[model samples]
Target: MKPRSRPTLARRLASGLATLVVLAGVAVANRPMVAVAGEALHTYQINRESYKKRYGHWARLPVPHDFRVNAIHAALLHTGKVLIIAGSGNNRDAFEEKSFRTVLFDPGTEEFTEVPTPTDVFCAGHTFLPNGNLLVAGGTKSYEVLEADVEHAAGVMKIKNESPDHGDRVFDKGTRLRSPAGLIYLTRTRVTVPAARKVTHGAHIMVHAGAAEVWVDAEQKGDGAVVQDPAQYTIDGLTGDDAKNLYGVADKITREKQEYGGDRTSYEFDPVAERYVRTGNMRDHRWYPTLIGLTNGEVLAVSGLDQFGRILPGRNERYLPGERRWVRAPELKRYFPTYPSLHMMADGQVFYSGSNAGYGSDTEGRTPGVWDVERNRFRAVPGLRDPRMTETSSSVLLAPAQDQKVMILGGGEIGESPVSTARTDIVDLDERQPRYRPGPDLPKPARYLSTVLLPDDTVFTTGGSSGYRGGAYRGEPRSDLFNSQIYRPAENAFATAADSTVGRNYHSEAILLPDGRVITLGGDPLYDETGKNAGTFEQRIEVFSPPYLFRGTRPTMAGGPTEISRDETASFATPDAARITSARLIRPSSVTHVTDTDQRSVAVDVVPAAGGVEITVPKRAGLVPSGWYMLFLIDDRGVPSVARWVRVR
Candidate 1:
């Protein structure tokens, strides 16, 4: 019989605090409890009663440190994989120790695979590049002695029970993974591409519906004859159909006493004559901002820390490249706000939230509500179950239900400027207005965390420092914190999610894999699994995968995408089948969606084939709204045709 474990310190603390709060002399009417079903998922930072009592504290999986990590960032790739970007783990022997913590979790098999990142690298920020790959950038790593910083890839983190450098015999310096070295320290990663390729200027939070562009870094070129100098750059207006060319946006990095020498904006040159042509400029200057490609061939750059390292100011800014205009937005008011996350709903509204700085305060500073795009304004996000939370938490767009979407806030901390709040929360955006709901509480996440949307429609959260027992505040990576969990909000379930198969943190990135796996690239590189060390170190990239999963229609061998040749470095993340690789190409079928899950199947006739069959569009499924069709074609034997967006007349 499987043995049952007792509740953890974090969980008990949350429950105890929740129990003590009384409605006071006031009737419970004003603050109604957030009712939830047994199957509802509870977020780490927000949960049911998170508002009523400001309850739910650090409740991590009671599992032993045996590789269990604190909390980290998350990335969902096109391949359906969830990348767990961990911070501080049990690894050694690399230059970049801090950013080295990482893990990969495959939702397909619920397994966690540990892969070390390169040195001095922290995937603090990144985005999907053109050519469907990913562009990881901007972060740094260092040694435990608080020594000199480096620019190379930092290795995995090495977590010790009581680290010596941290003043405990349990862990000492000169630790390494396999080889002996010291611990690593990582900071935000800085790089540019894919994003730069799309807009010459920075446009935040909007998606470019049909623009095509390309991105190139300091690497050998394969297609464009025009050498794109390595400074920040982007190349817009690729030939032929606007949607056919992949556009990459540029990101910039600035550090004191350092001269990476670059303009806020630039473009790559493919001089091939048939390649992309540069055109238009974004109206404003945006650095390291969130850029979303709209279905209308436009990109919206969202709020970000400025080149001067300042957060949003009195007024936010929006850039519309199609109109080539910069519009000032509502003053960015917040107690302490981090970058607000952006997600375009099925109904066409771009939703965002302001987050807490994780300093630990309650009422004065809180979360920024939602913004209704059609009205082009901000709406107070009411009924937030947890009042302490600011929009800064990493909230993701889950599968839609009843025209309402459940916004799940994954593992991350809350609070104002000084104290951090360890809790969780979920908001149901089903009604015209946002309603607060509660789900399962988090298993780990004392420091803070991130979440990723899975291809299968589940949510995976991972990594964070600081726990209930409490040791260090910042710069503390642990073994007991070694873990990545999954919260199936729809099913109301919580399990030991080994999705990306590794623990990650600080500047980490997680991208979805086509075949339902997750690929986590660069971040504060850590050290060995057993708590070893590497001196003044850094690291290399590692791949994470789960057990018992298939490589469905891998994109790699797909005739190398009838795309341009410049992306020699570009490789498909999917496993390729020869028949499908050489299979015939089909044309687009005009179609649209009537609801979130309702079917609007399109067709593609195959050569010399009869007796048609059906293969549901796993990716495009549930991705449509009324008056919208996720239409695409597939040849015989279930090979997919190129996909495009079209309006049903």
Candidate 2:
């Protein structure tokens, strides 16, 4: 055979063009076709569809209080009521007055009932117990501050041999007082004393006498000594960093400080009584801790600022539902970053996804890995290109809880950086050698994004800011993003959904309701539309009705066992058993900071029966954790009926 003859230039060009045409056709077919307000658009564009046939629509709900009271934390209870915890609302006035507020919202009645918090639970960590009670731990003890004013004195130095109550002491000439960090001032003059002593207690060096005042800085724990006053020389003054430091003072004063101490108080909210009852407190004070439910029906509390606003390393504790107390878990040697996103593996292990809220250093508990609770050992899983960017990132166990796959979405830099990344990555824990693989990038770099897993096996993400904590943007309306997107795991693609009426950013939350709708609430933008310092809290509640709601009529579910046994077929009555295609058990949410590891949607194996349907609950506690879950019946068109409450044990 003759050597391969070179093809003509025209033939080569034709072949290339044909190949391009085929590739283009494939791209067009694979790309998601999104319909926005009756207009079709490709997946690459931002589609503003308030009402789309295949997308969700947001409806503003009328709250009894007119607005949500700065809802920083929200949880769905088994009684179909939402527990909104405001806890001083992050306001200085409210915090100072000890106005810790909480409310129970009844979606069915559209009413809100005020619940009293025994202590300030602001910025605390919470999770639902197997008994359907919410266990909230840690909070603010007092607002710590530092300032120069006399009201905000740092400490008190008593003059040696001087009357503790009386003042106006005598000092010698050429005497000087010094403070390492703050200024020394005369309490009577209200003026800072010069570093060098030009004058003394007396007129001359022979027997000069003068009264001296020393003003120390706030948070100063040392005592100042008198330099002069040769005749029984003594100098004393009051000093402290903040109000909490005012130990012996009777007057109440406010001081300027950046940090606050964490509280060791804990409470359990009873849905039936609609009240928060004081429970056993934690061993260590924890602020911004992450509470995750374990497979054994206990809650693990990890990572938080201590009473002095310092990162608490190796301070792990477990909450017992029966005892209603938090016990130390000293075996857990590994420390986690603040608010680390933890998910339970099928084999009863906890996986830290390296996604933290804020605070903590890279060298301290920032590694991502699967943690063995029994052994207290961590198996590190590398492959995250930008592990440092996991701050404020969102991670979720993909649809069908049994999949054992976790996907982490957009996040920002370690600290309060304006920079954010749209990159996404996923890891399959089921693999023999698990490692992270690149996933689809987000439409935009977002922080504080709320990821809600829908009943239709689709992940719905909404409400995040392009800036740090939803501020510091270059365009109009600041940094908040109202756009929403849906992630389809089957296609591994993201499609534009509906745009929310209000923008949400930091301190915001979104959770799935029993009726197959999502309720988005509480956003603190930090600034107003004019870029001014305005505490713009998005208090309006917006409910999103998923596209499945518009897909014809929904099936009706009734008469299911209140409690379910593992590995057993539970029977339930459905209006259309032939049309029922799937059954799912969704754990009720106790979400905050976009880190809710307790919420999981487990798909149950369903089969048609003589009356309704027989659903088999997984025997493994890791698959269907011992707790209350909402049982939903989905029709062939993927429309789910109103969920009925069921306890899995």
lDDT of 1 by residue, 279-394 (tens): 23322233334444333333344433332233434234443444434455444322223334555554555555444333223343244455555465566666655455442345
- Model 2 weakest lDDT span, ten residues long: 244-253
Worst 10 residues of 1 by lDDT: 587-596
Model 2 lDDT at residue 290: 90
lDDT of 2 by residue, 1-649 (tens): 8899988757765765565556566657665322221132232122223244467677898876543598889999999988999898777799988888888878777788888777888889988888888888998865656554225333222222112233333433222223332334222213222221233456653322222232223332223322222222112333333111111211111233335667899988888888888888898888889998888888899988887566887779999888889899988866777888999888899989888887777667777888989899888988886777888899999879999999999888888788888888999999877888998998988889999988888899999988886777556447888889999999999988878878888888899999889989988876787666775677899988887887778999887799988898889987689999998999888777888877888999999987799999988887787878889899989899999999887
Task: Give the TM-score comparing model 2 with the true structure, all chains together.
Answer: 0.78
lDDT at position 64, candidate 2: 66
**Cα lDDT of model 2 overall?**
0.76
